[model samples]
Target: MRDIYAGSTEVIVWLGESGPKDHLGEMILPMLTADEIASLYQWHGDRRDLPKLAAYVSKVVEDRRKTGSAQDSIDIFGAFYVLSALISGVEASGIQELRHLHKSGPILRGFDALMQPRWWSRAWVVQEVVVAQSVTIRYGKLSAPWKIFSQAASQYERARLEANADSTYPYLKEQSLARFSRMILEIETTRNDWNQAEPVGLLSLLRKFRSRSSSDERDKVFALLGLVRFWRINEKKIMPDYHIDAIKVSFETTKSLLASVGSLSVLAGTLRYSECCDSNPSWVIDWNYPPTTNEDTRLFNLPWYCAGGSDGLIELHKQRVLKIEASYLDEVISVGEELVETTITRMRPVIMDWTKLCAQFIDTRPSFEHAHYIGGGSVGDAFWRTICGNLEFVKMGVNTSNFATTTVKKGFRKATADGSLAFEQLRSADYSHRRTTSIIGGFWQESNQPDPEIARRNAFHHAVECACEGRRFFVTKTGYIGVGPRNMSVGDHAFIPHGSQVPFILRNADRLVACQGDQIETLSSATGSQPTYIPAGKHAKAPEQQKVCYEAHSELYFVIGDAYVHGVMNGEAVRLETQAFWKTTSICLI
Candidate 1:
């Protein structure tokens, strides 16, 4: 049987539940090694990883029992063993700092200032120290609790020696002792308080700060302060000296948030960039170095929501960005190649009369006439904050290279391109002169290259466009159609019905109305009013209520049939349909 190490939450709760016995199991439990258990526990999972103490309390207690020789030491050690085991799980949680010896319980209580010098004098403190040191050694990381006790003991000993100095003046001696005593108390108190604070709460506070009003400078200040505290606690114990750089990155992020020049939305962009460092950033997909293609890498280009992580949307976006490199792009474009092959084989002639339909015209214009390839927004600047901060798809597009663009643009320019571009053009066109600029448009190896199947479709569309202009025929092709805010920032792409010439309609400030093949009126359109239509309207929608219907949860989707049916089935959709049609006249809905 393979041994499995519990996740963070499980580790802590396990320690609390199993106490010393589980600790023994974790140490001596054979199917896996200590290092393997540690690795498994460290990997991100459904819960937090267990701390050193909680994960190895049994080892600590057993070590004391084996080594300590004196009877009084043994008695005190026994008491220490019980208390340490009880708190091991909490220490393992890694989410909270567990420092206060006083509040810790009767067996492991705080040491008095006068009793600090002689370890033999205070049997309780000695027993607790022995257990704590043992746990720390086994765990390998020095936590806040370990530091507090260690520092307090050292300071108390030093203070006592000073008090005994013969040359020491009465007034000075008293003041020095008082100051030393106060310092020890303060450190101990702070350590306890630090441990009690929650990591989740700290993250929540940071997010809230990002969401707060930009105009409220004080709010930004308060947020920064909270972040500082969060990092400071980690500095003391949460992370080791080697990992301290992560805290520094977080601090720098706070500084950028403070200096950011835009609204709350803008500030969010600054904070987002800060999250990308090796430390706290939720996910990191190194596109430059592609790994063996797996489910993890395959979903890299999907939206963050579908990507598994602490937060769905954010994770998906991060993955898409990282996968924008050559290898990932190659994989996605290959999928597109499959799309071309499938669409070509399935192409059919139009049988419906064009003149029979009634056209309701809603005069609408494209939000932007041209797609500006804004590249390279400052990784952590205020300008990026103003525009694309909280914009989901823009983050998705920017992160994934999904939006059609060649150049990189940063800050307000990125924001402008992301939003309406109405705001951007108004400010300046010389994006080249800006502090951060990347080339706008040119060619990607996979996307720019023309495939025979894709070329045929493009030619078909061009032929149709030429006919619409040269002749009076307002011919509508069979595919999907959508209309609304027509922005990913505002609306979702809606599937239009087959053989429908439709007018664009804006549902509201946030939503778009989509008419699916003229069958139902519940589609969301703000994305585009193309000739495309989704095929699996029945499967896509629940039993009834097309408007308030079922949702698709698959990572990839497919564009099938003459009417563009884009849902859960992607490259597989093409294969499924192609294989089925050759065998039967009855079309099977996938």
Candidate 2:
């Protein structure tokens, strides 16, 4: 079977039973290996030739190794897994079931079953399906091209989005059905042909499938090696080293990436200390761990304003130290004792009181008085935008044309006639409510129809949902407003490290200790002071003491989180004129 698949021009898969199963006592079983059994558990129904299929694939890969080419097309025999069921002569009742509200449950269940195949979760599936020249999924006795299935899935996803935005479409509100369709659609779309002229970056490709699983942890990185564009250049260095441990692989991969790019920008993916395994270095990000929050902000291409330097450059030394060009910012004098988690409800109130929050900090730390220092108009605005989940609205100003501007202005005037309304009211609820109401009114007004109060409510709910999620905030001791991870503590220092777009949180590396009596007397003797009453022959060898060392220049620290430091955000952190004189030094991260 392996020899046949390796040399054949085409391959076929029968989703149905390939042969009769043997019954031993009361138990009926099919022959398969332990590895094969583990891999196929998620596959819903019996597939007797599953072992043969695995061998055929292995043989095909082996043949490619010897001849540089292998058969890339496969024709499946059964329609059970296919989107269309007519080929199997299974009654075409699923689609009809979707039309009736009562039958939608069974239809959704059938869709889910179709997508339950372990095939999607396999690591090898990425290379196989992506590199394939053609794939035909058979429905029972009927057949259709893979493109049809892909298009149908895509259409369903788009319809789902539309249904979510416009609540009028009841049929499209079937979330489970749409989700199942999307799962299949993504499999079709995410494939890379590898024959294209341009290729994606290794990091980008890895991030795309970071959520995928493998029985062996190392396979998470090894499986994607073939898809990496720089594999040829880095082959000798990063070749599949399954013999090594997962931690070593992670460190080596990160080191290679830093050396290749010559920048600390790669560290943007690093999460708060509380969020990651404490054993891993501050610079190393575990790609296997699923991302929790602000994933988009952590991307390589940060906004220009946030980056301290124009060029993303750094020096890699001995595979342990990173020397980057940066300006030094002020040390954190104080930080809030309480740490706020970035959960849903917690985030909402933070956004609602964004201005009041900043005011509380500004009263103590007056240095952050400058508006437009970091993209947003004011410090309050910057903090608000930083914590706001929807970057689209923050980056691009709200659309006012959709609202009745005159009406909104008049309403505000009437409400504030007594002049007792707080600024927070204008910025949070009132602002979003007015804009949302205007958009909904615009839709109805243009059509000259009665107001759709339900549509208005939906719009408002969507606005609130988008506004309150993602970032964690904190306040400093001197009344400075700092925005960072929820796990931040009182002593965490905020620094605008050079080359980075935003300020980073850092912690003290050394601890202070008190010594008394003989320990202190020994320290005094070591300083060339003779002990007045030294015992005979008791030459005091000064106790080995950890001395405090201070550098005239800057010190390196552990990066804990990103922040929006008030006064130091601009050129004040690192002097631009003397930037050339800035020495490159190694920061030892334990």
Candidate 3:
């Protein structure tokens, strides 16, 4: 392969078949040994693996040099990994996959198989394809550039998302297409030569490729080592070490990252115990499970007041515990269990269903004060705003003044006053007012007759979709409202530890004994045993007895979920004056 790159070899040909064409104008099949066939199918014969294979070829060539052989080194192979006759020439464009066809039709069946190849999920293929100088995909005699393949994959994804959005679209088998699209898009983004001024951080990269598979679990980190830039001065600690176990590798990588970044932002990749305990530490993120919800979206959209200070650091002690420099905030005095809820299997064009869900939540409120307490504002006002999807009306530049004067808000106010309005009636009134307003002064005034009412309804539906889908909505014992992952249990604590951006759901580590796998169980389980005083080198200690008391210093909590507590988002729900002072603390996670 290096010879080809060095202009020594003219070209390297790859044959799809070993036998010659038959006299009847059909190719004669070659009998292949199991080993030969298995080798051919390895890595799905992807073109992206060529560069890594070339490295091995280079090693062999160097060995020949030491032997003083007469043969010239084959520096480059200019290789092509071909898939022969995978798709018919007529249907190769993939447009037919979007159309309705017979359930067992051959065309759709073949396309499904083509899209579902394991090659798309392999960790090695990510680097191979991204680093390759050139690639050409051949399907029998028909050929397409890699660029063309990528564009097609993107189009397929857009079509799939559109189909999912429309209730009228026929049922489509989209798993294969979706997987292929994500793989190709990742290759496009991760290439070193790609002109990205600001590279994605390690946390974002890990989250993005979490679902990619690896035969050896540790390769999940090792394969991407080449792509991780040493952006931070201390990030140089992220070096590839194939010798270590997967668990140690994960811990070390996270420790190095935390040391370099100096923030708990790394916890953005953390998952629920049930989802990650088998493969990852209690504190380290498991980058194998794909995210079920848009936690990143919430992270970016959070109000500025929730931002944490920079005086935070993480210490890994004895390779089993994490000592964090954090401010001690509120403790979880009480919490409720997970709510029994229905998943949104498909997108609904109307917002009525979501409005009813919100109304049900309002009805669960213990008192009028609880409503205003959950989300900052009057109980009636918060209820109406959430129902109307007007929580960010001013920030989003929507006409809230007009919205306030609309019949929708008036009827909602009347309902609160009379205490007789049903959720269905409130929805109907909101829709009626929106439609009337759109017809009077909205885009409908033009001949195009654009339905702003539909847009408004869709916007409301989208907001609820993001807030509720794949999420668990829970109420604290004191009537505080927050949403977390669906796996959240009744006893999980909602805590806003100081120096943390958002509230985190915590579980008692002691109770996790039954579920802790052998690997995690070996780690320390005592949260109280972590050292309370700073090490001698980092800070001077007071007199022996005057040193901070272990119990009085700080408390640690397990991070279960990143929460969106309605009343606490603005920092008004929990007052700092009443709580303990913000002191650096250590959270012991197994």
Candidate 4:
């Protein structure tokens, strides 16, 4: 299918108002009413005195043409020119006015039709649209080039982002962007980026469109093989084979990715106690759904830190096992309340509770009226950096005097506070009782200057939310603070795999089976207090009567996803003073 689509000179797409149930895709030229077309052009085009709308659209089209996109297609440009004029007009007139306008009913109706179509959300559509040479979208006889839709979506995205700081810049609002059109724009960009040899990878694409629908789970992997770069696969293409089991596709993809991607950043997994998820091997990526958890910057581990350093160890075994050398960190002894509620309204109280938890271990509080991180190594600094994993602050466009950094030591280039702004509010969350004090505290008026405290708080709040999504705030036995997946247990160990960008939490897989397996016996190992397990079927003979009695101590571990432990984020694990308990060892993950 991909080869056919890729070889085609032009592909015509029947974008019906709805799915197959209405048979909109089968509509002929007569199906589109002349009145609907006229109504759309009038409401979206130059109605009267709004020259700015036309000017904005013209400028957007011109810029797109400069980028060699639909440069020769005047029809495409004209279509986009009118679409964005109205979509942007949504911001000026407000969504309520444009959405409810009787004269503009056709365009809104068109958007309504475009929103819920089955074609837009299907996983295979990614391959069809991306591989094709030229594409045209048709709603009955009313047709518009695919370039027009892509341009319109990109313009809406730009306007929506710009409107954030300026409330009056009524260009476009979020609601006006068609849901399916977003998928088109994304695939176009993916194709462009991949062709240009950008840093895009199969994992990134898989997670980006993971929500896309597909009847066969195997198609999720097969559909992407066409677009995935050969370099990411060790120059070996993953050919499709219907004979292969759907489960093996995941295992093969994971193993291939882990082998090729170098870093263990591909090792993302979860034990979703809340949902009825697949019982896949802990190392395999279940692509049918996205990762239950995300680490730094939505699973793209930021390059600022190298937690595991230069050491690299990867070993694939028979029976679906992965072994890697990791440095033992510590055990999670205490954890704060799980923050599952994701909303700005609920964020304050949730963070406040987490702050209180941090205060419990590090009782002493220092004044951070101006400084965020202490120059000397302090538990307070670790607590702050740990919770704010992947501050992602560099590109966040947040401005503050407190965005300050200093070298913690003379020869060490790494700063104590690399990329965090430890504002007074963040510092006082533990001790200050002023819950609703204005961000400036009436002090900014004295200087007659704006306060960036609100900005800092907003950024920090967002960072904490990103770092803790689908995860629980945990404190280790040695007083290290961080967030881990919800399934991280009290006795589970944290380790920084030699080549991984971030630390991870993994527990003895055999022990997990002993505790939770349907038929298993937990026994004490002959060597001290280490856990030993023996499996027995529910229908099998009694354990005493079993002929094969053997102490099973499988060193296999079920990997809990990546972590954001503060101290070890920047190669601290590699440079740690050699200790007996925190030494390196080979860990086998199942």
| Local distance difference test, each candidate | 0.22, 0.41, 0.42, 0.53
- What tens-digit string does per-residue lDDT give for candidate 2 at 353-441? 55455555454244434443333345644453343311221111224465565423211111111111122222333222223322231
Per-residue lDDT tens digits for candidate 1, residues 290-371, read: 1111112111112211101111001012111100100000010000101111111121111011111102111112211221
> Where does candidate 3 have its weakest 10-residue lDDT segment?
20-29
| Cα-lDDT of candidate 3 | 0.42
- Candidates sorted by lDDT, best first: 4, 3, 2, 1
Error of 4 at 208 (Å): 2.5
Q: Which candidate is the best by lDDT?
A: 4
TM-score of 2: 0.54
- lDDT of each residue in 336-428, candidate 4, tens digit only: 777673543345466667767766654345632222322235655555556666453332222333533441111112323532554334434
Count of clashing residue pairs in every prediction: 42, 14, 10, 0
As a whole number from 0 to 100, the lDDT of residue 357 in candidate 3 is: 42
lDDT tens digits, residues 1-590, model 3? 22232242222112122112101101111323344333332333345434433432254533442353223221111111111111111112223222323211222333343444566677755654554556554333323356644654544433332221222222344443444555666666565333353444555556656667898878787766555443443343355677888777777666655554455555643363463466555667665555644343333333333534323444444445555544433433323333222222343322333334444445535554344544456554444333222322111223446554532331121123212132222244332332332223111211223344433433343344444445655555555455565666677766554444566676656532122221221111122121122211223212111111122212434567666555454444234424445343456555
Residue 295's C-alpha lDDT in candidate 4? 32
Task: Show model 4 residue runs off by greater than 4 Å.
Answer: 18-113, 139-142, 152-185, 197-200, 232-236, 269-279, 292-297, 337-341, 366-384, 393-465, 510-554
